[model samples]
Target chain A: MDFVLDYISVTTFWTVLFIVHALLAVALLGALTHQAVAVWGPVRLASTPGGSAPGFVTRFRSVFAPSYAGVVCLLWVLAFIFGAIIYTKYRIYVRIPIEQQGLFKTLGAFELKEHLVTIGLGLLPIYWYLWKNARNAVYDSSRKWLTIVLAAICWYGFLTGHVLNNVRGFGS
Target chain B: MSAAAQTQSAPSDRRRIFALVFGVSFAVLYVVCDMAALPMFTYHPGSDRIDLGFTPARPDEGPAMYWFGWIATSALGAFVLALGAALLPQKAGAKIPLALAWIVPIALVPVLIYSLKFYWRW
Candidate 1:
C-alpha cells in the first residue's frame, strides 16, 4: 500500500483519470456517430444489421437506434462526470498557462466546446425519449435531428479535447 | 385499448413531455445565464470555494469559473419547469410542437457562438 501510494502521485493519478476520460469520450464519439448516421431521413435501423453485403458506410449506419439510446445517455453522463472532475485540475494548471501564454483561439475553442457539451448534456433526456419512441412516426423527425445535434457536439468536443491534450496531456 | 395499455400511456406521455420541456428550457436558460453571467453559483478554483452568485478572485486566488454554475442554473430551472409541464393535463402538452425539442436549441447554437465572439480571431 505504501509503495503503491508513493508511486502514484497526485499528478499521476490525475493523468490516469484524464486518459480514462479521453477514452470514454472516444467511445461516446463512436456511438453517437453511428446512431446519428443511422437515424437520418427514413429514421430506420436494421434489427440485426440484415442486408445484402452493404457497403462500409451503409454498414456503419446500420445499427438499431433504440439500442443505442441508453448506452449513449450513460456514456454521455459518464464522460461529463469524469470531465467535471478533471476540469478542476485543468483550471488550476492547464487553463491558466494557456491564458498567460496567449493561446486565445485554443482557449476560446475550449470555451465553445464546454458550452456546446453542456447544451448537449441538456439534450440527453429528450434524445433518450425520442429514440425510445423511434418506431412512432410522430417522433421520427425529432429523433433524427436530435441525434445529429448530439453527434455534432460529441465530434467538436472530441476534437477540441484531442488538440488540447496534444498541447498538454499526450506528452505523458 | 386494454387497461394495461391505458395505464402505460399516461406515464410515458408525461415522461415525453418532461424530457422535451427539459431539453428546450435548459438550452434557452443556459444561454441567458452564460451571457448574463448570472449563474446559480460561482466556483473560484484558486480559493477552492464555490460562492453563490458571481464573485471576483477574493483576497488571493486566480480566476473564477462560472461555467459549472451556468450549467447548474439551467439544469435546476429547467427541472422545475419540466416537472410542471409533466404534471399539467395531457391536453395542454399535446399542443407543444415536437420540433421545438431540437429546433430551439439548434437555432440558439449561432447565438451561443456569437456570445463567444470575444474569442474570435477576426
Candidate 2:
C-alpha cells in the first residue's frame, strides 16, 4: 500500500499531464476532422460543374466556420501560455551542481537566443504575413499560402526551441 | 480547368479548404508540442520547482492566478479569430464552415474550465 501511494505521489503530475494532453489530442482531432468534413469533403462531392453545392454540406460549412477558426486560435494561445507556465515551474535554466559551469553558461546563452530572441524575430514575419493577408478584401490564394508557410515555420521553430531548451535527466 | 478559370470557378470552395487546412495543421502542431512538454512536469508534490517544459518553478503558489490567465488568453485569441470569420462574405455555402469556426471556441470553454479545476485544493 505504501509503495502504491508513493508511486501515485511521484506520478501525479504525469496523470495530470496525460489528462491535459489527451484533452488537447482530442481537440486537435476534432478540429482536423471538422475541417476535413467541411472543406475537402464538399469540394470533392461537388466535383461536377454547377452541382448545386451539395445541400447538406453547404448548410454545415456555414454553421461551422466561426466556431472552427475561433476554437483553433484559442487553443493555440492556451498551448503557448501553458508551455510558458511549465517552463516557469521547472528550473530548466538553472545550473546543476558538479557540471562544468561553462556548459551551463553555453546553455544559458542558447536559451535566451532560442526563446526570447528567436521568438521575437519569428513573430514579426508571422504577424506581418497574417496582417498583410488580413488587410485584403478577398482571400488571396498566394497570400493565404504564404501565411500557411510562415505559420508552419513559426510552429516548427517554437516547438524545436522549447524542446531543445528542456532536455534533462542526462548527466544531472 | 485553367488556373484563372479554376480560381474564379469556386471561390467559396477554396476559402473553405484554406480554413480547414489552417485549422487542422495548427491544432495538430499544438497537440504534438503539449505532448512533448508533459514529461518535464513529473515531480514530487512539494518540490520547489515543477517542470513544465521550457522552465521549472513553483506553480502551486498561485494556481488560480495562472488558471484565469490561461482563460483570458484563450478568450482573446478566440475573439480575434471569430471576428475574422464574421467578416468573411456570407453565402449559403459558407454558412456551415462559419458556424463550425464559431462553435470551436465555445466548445473550448468547458474544456479549459475542467482542466483548470481538475485538482483544485481550497
Candidate 3:
C-alpha cells in the first residue's frame, strides 16, 4: 500500500488501519447495544399511565435506535474492509502457525468472526429499512425481531474477534 | 384504514415479509454453509489451488473460494426458500416473520456445531 505520507512506515500504515477498525467496531457495539435495549426493554414513563413519555434513557435509546442503522452499516462495512487488509498479514504470520499448533478453537473463532461480519453486511439493507420505518405499527414486531437478531450477530462477532485478537495480536 | 384498503395492502405486506425473510435467511445460511465447509465449489489456494477453474499461484495467496462459493450456494438456497414462501396463501405469507423468528435461530445451530467439531475433533 502506498502511503500518502512518505514518513509513514508500512507497519504504521497497518497499525493505523487496525486502530481505525477497532474504533469502528467499538462504535458499532455501542450502537447495536442501545438499539437492542430499545427494542426489547423499552422503559415507560412512570408519570404517565399511558406510557406516553418514556424515561430519559429510554427516550435517548429510542432516538438512538433508529439512527444507528445507517451508522452501523457504514462502520461495519468499513471495518470489514480494514480487516481484509489486515487479514493478509494475519493469514501468513498468525493464522497458519496457530492452525499448525492445533489450536483449532481460536482458529475456529476467527473463522466464525469473519463469516459473521460478511453475513451482517448482507443484512444491512433490510436492517436499515426496518429501522427507517420503525414507527409503522404493523412492522413493529418485524423490526424488533430483526434488531435483536442483528445485535446478536454483532455481539458474536465482537466477542469472537476479541478472543482471536488476544490469541494472536493483529497484523503481527 | 378502510376494509378495502387493508385488503389491498395485504399482498404488499406479504411481499415485504418475504423480502425480509430472504435477506436475513440468505445471510445466515451463507455463513452456515461456509462454516460447515459445504461450498458448492472448492478452491484451496495451497493445494491444487484451482477453484472454479481459476488457479492462484500460492495457496496462501489465492482467491477465497469460501466467499464466492458461499454466495452462490446461499443465493440459490435463499431464492428457493423465498419463492416457496411467496407462493404460500396470503394467510401463510403473513406468518413468514413468525416462522423466521424460530427458523433463523435453528439455522444458526450448524455454525456452533461446526466450530465445536473442529475444537473437539469430534
Candidate 4:
C-alpha cells in the first residue's frame, strides 16, 4: 500500500497527468473546431458554392458533432479530477507554514468558489441564450460579442486564480 | 449596367470576403495571444532543486514556450474550421463568423491548463 501510494506520488505521476492533459487538450480543440464548422462553414460556403468549402465543412461537422459535447464535458471533469488529485497528493494547500498559509489558502478557496459559481450560475444563462436565440433572426453582433467576452472573463478568472493559488511551494 | 456586365458580377463575393477576413484575423489573434502567454524558453528546472523534481521559479522559465505550443495547437483547429467554413454551403446570407469565434477559447484551454499547473507548482 505504501509503495502504491509512493508510486502515485512520484513526478512520473505528473508526467502522466500532463499526458492526459494533452489528450484532453486535443479533444477540447477538436470540439471547438467541430462547433465552428457546424455554425459557420455552411454559411460561408453558401456564398461560394462549387468552391469545396461547403462539402468539407459538412463532412467535418458530421464526423465531429456527434461526440463533441460529450468529449468537452469529459475534458472539464477530468481536469477537475486531476487538479484535486494534485492538490491532495502534494499536500499543497493544507501543509503550508502558518505564516504563509493564509494567502495560499485564500487564493485556492477563491478559485474554487469562482469556478463553482461560474459553472453553476453563469453557464446556465449562456446556455439559455444559445437555446432561445437558436433561430431568432435578430442580427445582433453584440450578442456574439457578449458571449465571447463572457468566455474570456471566465477563462481569465480561471487562469489567474489557479496561478495565484499555486505560486506558494507545496507546504511552504 | 450592361447585360454581360451583370452576368459576370458575383453576388456572393462580399460574404466570401467577410468570411475570409474573419477567419484569417481570428487565426492571427490566436497566434498572438498564445505567443504573449508563452514563457521564454529555458532549461528545464533541475530535479534536485525541489521534491517535485522540477522547478520553474519565474515566468521566464517555461510559461511562454507552453503558451505558444498551445496557440499552435488551437491555430491548427481554427485553420481547419476556417477552411471548412470557407468550403461548406449554407443559406444565401448567413453572416456568422463561426470559425473565428470558436477559435478564441479553444486556443485558450491549454494556456489555462498551463497556468493552473504553474500555479499549482509556482
DockQ of each: 0.46, 0.04, 0.25, 0.02
Ranked by TM-score, the better of candidates 1 and 4 is 1
For model 1, which pairs clash?
A: none
lDDT of 1 by residue, B1-103 (tens): 3444434433348888898899999999999999998888889877788999887667668778888899999999999999999999999986777788778
What is the fnat score of candidate 2? 0.00
In terms of lDDT, model 3 sits at 0.67
Instruction: Order the numbered candidates by TM-score, best leading.
Output: 1, 3, 4, 2
- The Cα local distance difference test for each model comes to 0.83, 0.38, 0.67, 0.41
Cα lDDT tens digits, model 4, A47-138, are 66556544564677554332344444455456545544453433333334422544544454444333332232212222233323443323
The TM-score leader among the candidates is 1
Estimate how well candidate 1 is docked, as a DockQ score.
Answer: 0.46
TM-score of each: 0.88, 0.32, 0.73, 0.34
Off by over 4 Å in 2: A1-11, A18-67, A93-137, A141-143, A146-172, B1-122
Question: Which wins on DockQ, candidate 2 or candidate 3?
Answer: 3
Give the TM-score (vs. native) of candidate 4.
Answer: 0.34
- lDDT of model 2, residue A109: 36
DockQ of 2: 0.04
